[model samples]
Target: MTGSLQGETVLVVGRGSGIARAIVGAAAAEGAQVVAAGRNREALESAYKGTSVSVKGVDLTDEASIAALADDVGSVHHVVSTASARARGALGELSPEAILLSFHTKVVGPIMLAKHFAPEMPRTGSLVFFSGVAALEPDPGFLGVAATNGSVNVVIRSLAVELAPLRVNAISPGTVDTGAWDGLGEKKGAFLEKLSAANPARRLGTPEDIAQAVVFAMTNTFMTGVSLAVDGGQPLV
Candidate 1:
């Protein structure tokens, strides 16, 4: 609304849908030059077709890929990483590979991003990452998810201090209707309904809701090294 991002470049790393797409839209609406990058470059190109958005390829698990992306994009005003590998299972069901993938994708990957991109960013530039309510509201089946998110929370603080003036923060989302639960099949609706009623906000979160918070994190000059919770109060109850 403020068009504060006009003429600025924003690079968002994630799949071309869900919260990532919403963020691209939000930033673009604020007059930013948005680049959407993920493993599926063709899909992203198609997704943003006819728009001002550009598309690129990236794999969070690969540090080289991240570095190359940083080179390709050059200087940017802000960067948002929404990529995550979900390892949803109980202790017995969780595998070492799955856990490693989760950490590699969410934790180590972003670190690599900062390593390569920070040099190209202005002092006013910022980085936004995705943490989750799982870190705060630990549950049985989401152990891996929680651990990865918890690491992100700590990383945000460390990076904020280390990167100083280059703002680093995260957005922790509660239960959202992002089709992440569609794998639940018929049970998905009921699952969301239960969470909606339980959440203090009395509704499931939307990509746009999280996007609005991200805009704040990117534009707010003084805020850094913090994880913003945009989960509609799901962790409280």
Candidate 2:
């Protein structure tokens, strides 16, 4: 917790989330060199430019692109993914294309990072992925997202054991106010209120709230193979 991560390099995927940004900032503050990777090069640079961070724009679905990204990343101690794709639609209305799109981004994409980078991750570094509350607390229209997150969560957990020498973990955040749901603006408030009402905290979790946990997981050596929920007790409901 104290200077435990100095001089470590953390490769952060999906630098777009508020939570991801917070995590990057915290990691940098803690003396870890962070390289932010995502599809939006401009956005990542706009957000994290001029720092020690090196932002790379990449489409994780593309093997060559991800491989190039992994090559550029070189050796690192940690890989944290906040990258998620939106393919949400009603169940029957969801085509195989949409469902697969979500899975490719949320599950398959992170797996690619491990595929290419695990061999390079330092023994002490960890791999952390992100899941949404949707995975556990489902919504009828968000079936694709829920299922993908669930799969990714399990994949990361299982990988933790499989990649024994290397550590892996995931964070499931509840209703963090990120722009991911910008299209669902109207429904966002009403649904979140209803969901938050059931939790003892009586509020939705924030990105910074989740960031601290992510950093905690990176610094702690004992924790792995689990997707910790930062849901403000939403599970109790």
Candidate 3:
């Protein structure tokens, strides 16, 4: 790590595992004071125990919770949100509630975080949100997921323009072995193998892959309103 974020404070909003956990570790490795926040404050605290990361509670679906978190965290140099509610199912199996939850958690939540946290961040500060390859390479049984991620890819552009000197970007990941596919159960290994073969890189992604891209986005002042695809060229094929 170049310690590009040395002395800077980074706030990462998400659960205490998978990509979110990896992001926290990555930011800390870059010499930033990282805060791991989510709805489960206790879990975060426990997960990050014995580490430098601090834990806080914030519900993405609720504005009041976000505002309260902003008040608690006060000033921050960079903020990264990795929270997402995936509605994985075909059109017929999808419910209105699931779609709405996906949109609210992945799309609307990051926007609100920017709104409240922007006031406290400096001009050089950046905001990184999580998008996914589902948006770029649409697939069946993930319509809601695609729509939610697609919205994020667009919103960051508007946010960058509106926020000006404050950088806004997103990290779009492909099939990362962050245990997200664990729900696939017995088929998880075969599914990953198939994806790896199809991907141009001939491999599935990892949480560290996405986290490294996020660090780049946050530190590169020239980059904004862009969605960095750290999908190992999965979208290429």
Candidate 4:
């Protein structure tokens, strides 16, 4: 890290846990004034405890709420949205509401962020959106997740061109050991082990891995409209 972000302001949405929290810490360590935004105030507070990060509440599904956050945040040097609605099940078992909500959270929300925040972003500023490896290597029960994340790749490409000079890109991660897998309880470790053995890297990804990719996307002035996969070769095999 070259400390290139020093003295810049970075707004990281979805700071509840997992990769988002890691990103907040990494940005602050790089000397950025980090603003952590999420729907859960308590979670945000907990994740950013003892840090100088500012916390704010913003609901991705609500346009007015995102606009309000933009108004409050004012100008920013970069923005990254890790916000996602967790809705997964087999195709026949899933609900329409859950599927729609997933798209709204991952797809619509980022669009709204660009709609409102683009004007405030300088030519050198960038926007990074999070996608997932499931979009490339689909499984049986992750239909909605694959669809939503796949859409993000398309959205970022279009936005990069439309937004021009204000670089836009996406990061697609593989199975990472984030709190999102806590529901597996005692089986979480074994599950991760299985995935690790299958991956070419022979390990599950860490939040730090994803955070580093995000920082790279933000600072690489020559990169844009690209969906870089930090999946430890999960998509390859």
Model 2 TM-score, all chains together: 0.93
> Which residue pairs clash within candidate 2?
none
* lDDT string, candidate 4, 119-226, tens digits: 998999999999899899989889999999999999999999999999999999999988788887899888888999999999999999999999999889999999
lDDT of 3 by residue, 147-203 (tens): 999999999999999998999999999998877789999999999999999998998
Candidate 1, 1-237: lDDT as tens digits: 789799899999998889999999999999899999999999998899999898999998998999899988899999899999999999999999999999999999999999999988999999999999999998999999999999999999999999998999999999888878888899998888999999999998999999999999999999999999998888898
Ranking by TM-score: 1, 3, 4, 2
Candidate 2 residue spans exceeding 4 A from truth = none
- Root-mean-square deviation of each candidate, in angstroms? 0.7, 1.7, 0.8, 1.2
lDDT of 2: 0.84
Worst 10 residues of 3 by lDDT: 203-212
User: Which stretches of candidate 3 lie above 4 Å from their native place?
Assistant: none
